[model samples]
Target: MSERILALMGPTASGKSSLAERLAERFDGELISVDSVLVYRGLSIGAAKPDYPHHLVHLRDPVDPYTAADFARDAKRCMKEIIARGRRPILVGGSMLYFRALIHGLDDIPSIDPAIRTAIENEAREVGWPALHRELAQVDPASAAQLHPNHSQRICRALEVYRGTGVPLSSWQLGEAISQADQFECIALCTEPRAALHRRIECRLDGMFAEGLIDEVRALMARGDCHSDLPAIRAVGYRQVWAYLQGEVDLPTCREKALVATRQLAKRQLTWLRSWPDLTWMNTDDAGRLIQVDKTAIEPVKTDENNEIAAVEPVWADRIESLMRNF
Candidate 1:
């Protein structure tokens, strides 16, 4: 088994892909992306998927369903294969749910009946999600407390779980966590500065537009497999661009909405990074620091590689106590 695995994580456009590529080349590793949108075939520009070959990417059609569970499964397979080939595996991307699923594992969730889901949807439409959220507070206040009123999908899923099994969603989530996040030995890296990440996101969105994001959305729509409800089309920039293509908003308005949405996504990512355990924090803004850190980190790898049939590999553990101090 390969002893060295690195989970390179950061918010979108935080130079994660570039850093992962550099490390992968230096260490002879394969890249595995953990993104939901990147799984769909036609979401390249909007998703910002790497141009190079990577695992768990472009494996599904636009309409084919995917979940974090699916990602965890495929990622495990990819990692195993990479290890068997005598190379390191570098997990990359910013999808928090996929990372959580991979680390914490998932429970056997209750399946919602179609009729029940439809009924809940109708009620939400009539009374609004916030009102329905209040009702959820009555039945399952614990789950409701953790979820936002505007998060209709999760709120509805929780209600559906309760309606189907007469059990709180929170109970199932707690009871069935795989609890194997700590078993995997890997290096976790994260960047800082929410303002810098926000700026990077804005620039990426602009680049996506310049790369014909509307044309890409148009092509996907032409395929007739995607719509506003599908996860692929609902992805940050894709949603706004699809709206613009449908004549609902102008190009500039679409760009602005997408930028705002991306910023919100960055904020959520930063929150998750702050709570993540055992991560190496580095200022990505400092190229000199990166060069020095890389130099300091490379000797362990060189020593490990020099020994054939090595019994043990040293884990280069670096914990910056104040990993998210800037955030």
Candidate 2:
């Protein structure tokens, strides 16, 4: 029989790590981080990576540039290894793209012609992103609808795809029939009231600052390994912090911008998660029930003579209590 793969997914500051850690203990599972920013080695403060070992897969490494493909490959490898060792694999984090790529194969859209890319980029530079978006809307409204008005890179790519392949970007994506794993189950935990989530986001940002987030970004910048355009650097906190370091904005303005960005990111995450079919949605207010249900689900297969899996129950209960206390 195929081993079970459980995904514990939610937005930033949504207590996903705590929940996943507890779940891991209960189920004898190893965690594979699905976060994009956490893949960078020195980005701990802003990424919020836990100090404890949890079978991390795509965590920060200074020497490597981690991509979605890299994550997918490593995640699959980790799952196999964990299963081989008689443990379940628990996928956790807020990276929607990574999750999507894992469950649904990334579309193999035709590569852009260099000339077309240059043409679209030149148009964006000369006419502005709005004009480029309008051009995409004229050619591929479906693709345009999936992108934000300010998402210049995707908009440019969509336009380039149309110009180069004579096919709409949406059509290519539709043509790719990706299959999901048969043994996988997804649980999406959205801790709400919306007001509470907003407050949590604000508090988390303040805590990040207190944790020396600025110095972390300064160190990253010092290495000259990343820039504003790189997807990793454009993560919610890093972009705003980078702007402040570049003198494009004051410190207070940067903090406010980061907070706003995190809120927006959380909203987007909620929206994306809500759209997932067959996802078991759980409210954070009823976390104990969720943990109980998860624990019950995994109890039957557990059979270690030393009762290692059984030993983790009290730990799970304690972490849940601590998390609820903070909540």
Candidate 3:
């Protein structure tokens, strides 16, 4: 039997975790989170992580850095262990970059040079990230489009990659993939309907504030070990709330900014989902529409001897549509 995993992906506030929990129960699978922020130990309410026990959640201190490469390594190990235990591994979250890293593998860029990083940060401190973004547009427009101007960490990394090696980070990805497509035998599940998703975003952000998102940020700050410049602090909701705590913005402005940031995050996630090569787009965001992970969808992904996914009969596609449709 070929190894198979279920990848449940969606934008922030799209009910992915809830659906994943139910799918895990139905399919007898273990859960693996694909989130950048969920790795941070103290980032709970602001990150909007599910209030349940899960692997890969709260794995690191907020001050520590956890790269996509790190996540891919950990995720692959967890998946193998889960499969060995006779259960499927259901990977879940909105971190699309992590998904891509796991599927396609990371590019061979030079390791982080502190001198280069400090130079980029010094430049950012002077003219801000938009100037650096314009510079990236000149060199690597593809990466710039995938990133937001306010995404200082990625923006800095892209620039560092270019400056450190004189090669574009996006260009490196265009080369060969390190992993075979059929090795994971995973099918991505996502949803659409822009207006409905936006509504959910608004409601979720409002609920986050009501649930003491500010207090959570405050607690992390009170720890004194964590700082606003850490990668975890730059996460959508926490960034805005931290600014409010720093007196950089008022409460109303913070709430407004946080909602906008989350909406933008959702939009980027949607872009990634639509671009995914092996995605099965679910028409509805309502988990009730498809209550379980139907096993039939994974059984027919025939692969050639070279381990590439082979073209199967149309019946397989139809079966997937039937089993995964939001009816």
Over 89-141, each residue of candidate 3 has an lDDT whose tens digit, in order, gives 77888888888788777776667678999999999999999999989999999
Most lDDT-accurate candidate: 3
Model 1 Cα shift for residue 232 (angstroms): 1.0
Off by over 4 Å in 3: 175-179, 184-192, 285-327
Model 2 lDDT tens row, 232-308: 67778988999999999999999999998899888778767765666655555422233453323221112147422
lDDT tens per residue, model 1, 1-327: 324456767667767777677766755678999788999998899999788778988999988889887998898888888878877777888887688677767678757688988999999989999998888899898778755686677788889988998988766655233346644433433333456667677777888889888899999999875788788888889999999999999988999999988887766665565555665443455221232224244212111263221232233323211111111
Q: lDDT per model, in order?
A: 0.71, 0.71, 0.75
Model 1 misplaced stretches (Cα beyond 4 Å): 1-4, 133-149, 175-179, 185-192, 286-293, 296-327
In candidate 2, position 78 carries an lDDT of 82
Give me the overall lDDT of model 2: 0.71
Poorest 10 consecutive residues of model 3 by lDDT?
318-327
Query: Better model by TM-score, 1 or 3?
Result: 3
Clashing pairs in 1: none
Give the distance in Å from residue 287's predicted Cα in candidate 1 to where it truly belongs.
8.6
Model 1 residue 135 distance off true place after TM-score fit, in angstroms: 4.5
